[model samples]
Every structure is written in structure tokens, then in C-alpha cells.
Target: MTEAELQQLIFDGLRKIAPESDPASLRPDQKIRETLDIDSFDFLNFLIALDERLRVEIPEADYGKLNTLDGMVRYLLAKLPK
Candidate 1:
């Protein structure tokens, strides 16, 4: 998928997991969990949701790399089929 699509998917997943989160105020470089006040459980669910929608398995080991919007986008971009 394209970068724009990935970003949109991420935002949509965030909304599902954290309806109070304001995606419009999200900074790409900022830490998503801390910035959005997302707890561990919610974060995991968000990741799972992303995997379900994108059909890409993000291993637990790589969870740390997806702390920011840019990070998730970059990581997913590499894993997604061209």
C-alpha cells in the first residue's frame, strides 16, 4: 500500500482503539502511546487491528520500532507488498 493509505489506516485504527484521540493533532515524530495517552492494552489492540487490516504481521520484537507515526509508516512500508 502507499504511504498515504498506510497513514490513513493507522489513523483509523487509532480512532477505533482510542476514540478520544485527536489524530489531527498527532505529530509524526512524537511517541504515539505517550502522546495519545494509550495504555499497553489499547496499544496492543491497535497493533492487532493494523495487522488485521493491512494483512502484515508485526512481530512483538518490532513493536518498539513503531512508537511514532513515522516509525510505523516506515516499518509498514517496508513490510507491505509493493
Candidate 2:
């Protein structure tokens, strides 16, 4: 998928975890969990949701790389097929 599409997937995942959050308003350089006020469980669910949607398994050790929107997009793009 394209980068824009990947970003939308991230937004959807975040929305699923935190319905009150405005995923579109998230700062690309900021920490998504802290910004959304979500705890670890919710964050794991978010990542799992993204994994299911994108068919990409994100290793737990790589979780830190997904802290920001920009980072998530970059990491996912690298994992996704060309």
C-alpha cells in the first residue's frame, strides 16, 4: 500500500483504541500514546489492529519505533511490499 494509505490505517487503529481521540490532529513528531492518553493495553491493541489490517507482524522489540506517526509510517513502509 501507499504511504497515505498506511497513515490512514494508523489513524483508524488509533481511533479504535481511543474513540475520543482526533487521530487526524496527531502530531507526526509526538508520542501517539501520550498524546491520545491511552495506556499500554490500548496501545497494544492499536498495534495489533494495524498488523491485522496491513498483514504485517510488528515485533515487540520494534514497538518503540512506532511511537510517532512519522516513525510508524516509515517503519511500516519499510516492512510493506513494494
Candidate 3:
């Protein structure tokens, strides 16, 4: 998928984790936890949802590096097929 498409997927999945969040309005650089209030469970759900969509397993240890939307996008980009 394209970067923008990946970004949208992450946004959509995260928005679902925090139903009240306005993912569309969030800036690309915004931190998912601080800005979107995504707790540990929500983060795990996000990882699971993304993994399902991308058909890859995102290790739990790597999840710590994805504390922000941008970070997550970067991580996905690295994991996704080039």
C-alpha cells in the first residue's frame, strides 16, 4: 500500500480504538497516546488490526517504538513489502 493509504488505515484503526477521537483532524506528527488517548489495550488492538490487514505480526517489543502516529507509520512501512 501507499504511504497515504497506510496512514489512513492506521488512523481508521486507531479511531476505532478511541471511538470519540477525530483521527481525521489529527496532525501527522501528533502522538497517538498523548493526543488520541490510546491506552495500552487500545495500542494492542491497533497493532492487531494493522497486523490482520497487513498480514504480518508486529512484535510486542516493537510496539513500544510506535508511541505516535508517525512512529507507527514508519514501523509499518518498514514491515510492509517494498
Candidate 4:
């Protein structure tokens, strides 16, 4: 999937976890947890939702790489099947 598609998928997952969040206002370089006030549990659920939607396993070690919108898109772009 393209970066835009991945970004949308991430936003969708975030919506499910944090309904109050305004996806459009999210900064690409900002940390998602801090921006959304997402606790550990919510973040885990968001990751699970993304994994289910994208059919990709995001290992724990890579979680740091997904902390920001731009980072997540770049990480997924590299990991996603060709």
C-alpha cells in the first residue's frame, strides 16, 4: 500500500482507540501517544488494530519506530509486502 493508504489505516486505528482525536490535526513528526494522550493499553490496542487491518506483524522491537505518524508510515512502507 502507498504511504497515504498506510497513514489512513493508522488514523483509522487511532480513531478506534481514541475517538476524541482529530486525525487531521495530528503532526507527522509528533509522538502519537503524547498527542493523543494514549496510555500503554490504548497504544497496544491501536497496534493490534493496525496489525489486524494490515495483516502485518509489528514486532515489539519496532514499536519505537512507529511512535510518530511519519515514522509509522516509513516503517510500514519498508515492511509491507511488495
Candidate 5:
């Protein structure tokens, strides 16, 4: 998927976890948890939702790389099947 598409997927996952959050207002370089008030459960759910939607496996060790929007796109781009 293209970078823009990956970003949109991430935003979609975030919205699923935090419906009250405005994904467009989130800073790409900032931590998503802090930006969206995403608790541990929300974060996990977001990851699960993304994994299911994207058909990508996000290992627990790499979860830290998904903290920011930019990071999430980069990480997913690398992890996605070529």
C-alpha cells in the first residue's frame, strides 16, 4: 500500500479505538496515546483492529514503533508483504 493509504488505515484504527478523538487533529510526530488519550486497552484494540484490517502481523516488540503516526506508517510499510 502507498504511504497515504497506510496513514489512512492507521487513522481508521485509531478512530475505532477512540471515537471521540479527531484523528485529523493528531500530530504525526507526537505519541498517539498521549494525543488521543488512548489507554492500554484502547491501544491493544487499535492494534488488533489494524492487524485485522491490514492483514499484517504487528509483533509486540514492535508496538513501540507505532506510537506516532509517522512511525506507524513507516513500521507498517516495512512489515507489509512486498
Candidate 6:
């Protein structure tokens, strides 16, 4: 899938998991933890859900790389099927 498609999916998933999230205002450059007030458990759940949906296993070490929305998109794009 294209980067935009991946991003859109991520946004949709986030909104599905986090009903309070304002998907429209989610900026790619923004820090997800800070901007979304996401705790460790929520972050882990996000990754796990994404992995299950995409059928890709994200490395645990790569969690730090997903601090921002753009970073998450890049990581997912690299791991997910095109």
C-alpha cells in the first residue's frame, strides 16, 4: 500500500482504538505519546493491534522509533506489505 494509505489506516485504527482521538487533527510530525496522552499500555496495544492487522512483527527496539506519527508511518511502511 502507499504511504498515504498506510497513514489513513493507522489513523482509522487509532480512532477505533481510541475514541477520544481527534483523527483530523493528528499531525504526522507530532509526538504521539505527548499529543495523544498515551500511556505505555496504550502504546503497546496500538503496536500489537497494528501488527496483527498488518501481519507484521515490529521489533521491540523499534518502539522508540515510533514516538512521532511520521516515524510510526515510516516504520509501518517499511514492515508492511506494499
Report model 3's TM-score to 2 decimal places: 0.86
Worst 10 residues of 5 by lDDT: 7-16
lDDT of 1 by residue, 1-82 (tens): 7889889988988888889888758889999999988999999999888888889999999999999999989999999988
Flag clash pairs in model 3: none
RMSD of each: 0.8, 0.8, 1.3, 0.9, 1.0, 1.4
Clashes of each: 0, 0, 0, 0, 0, 1
Candidate with more favorable, higher lDDT: 4 or 5: 4
Name the TM-score of candidate 1: 0.95
The TM-scores of all predictions, comma-separated, are 0.95, 0.95, 0.86, 0.93, 0.92, 0.87
Candidate number achieving the greatest lDDT relative to the actual structure: 1
Per-residue lDDT of candidate 3, residues 1-82 (tens digit): 8989998887789778998988877776777687887777877777788888999777777867787677778888888888
The all-Cα superposition gives candidate 3 an RMSD in Å to the true structure of 1.3
Task: Give the Å shift of residue 39 in candidate 2.
Answer: 0.7
User: Given candidate 5, what's the lDDT at residue 12?
Assistant: 80
Candidate 6's error at 74, in angstroms?
Answer: 1.0
User: lDDT per residue, candidate 5, 3-80, as tens digits?
Assistant: 988888788888888899888787789998998899999899888888888888888999888888889888889988
Which candidate, 5 or 6, would have the higher TM-score against the true structure? 5
Q: Is candidate 4 or candidate 6 better by TM-score?
A: 4
Better of 3 and 5 by TM-score: 5
Ten residues in sequence with the least summed lDDT for candidate 6: 15-24
Q: Count residue pairs with overlapping backbones in model 5.
A: 0
Compared with the true structure, all predictions reach lDDT values of: 0.90, 0.89, 0.81, 0.87, 0.86, 0.80
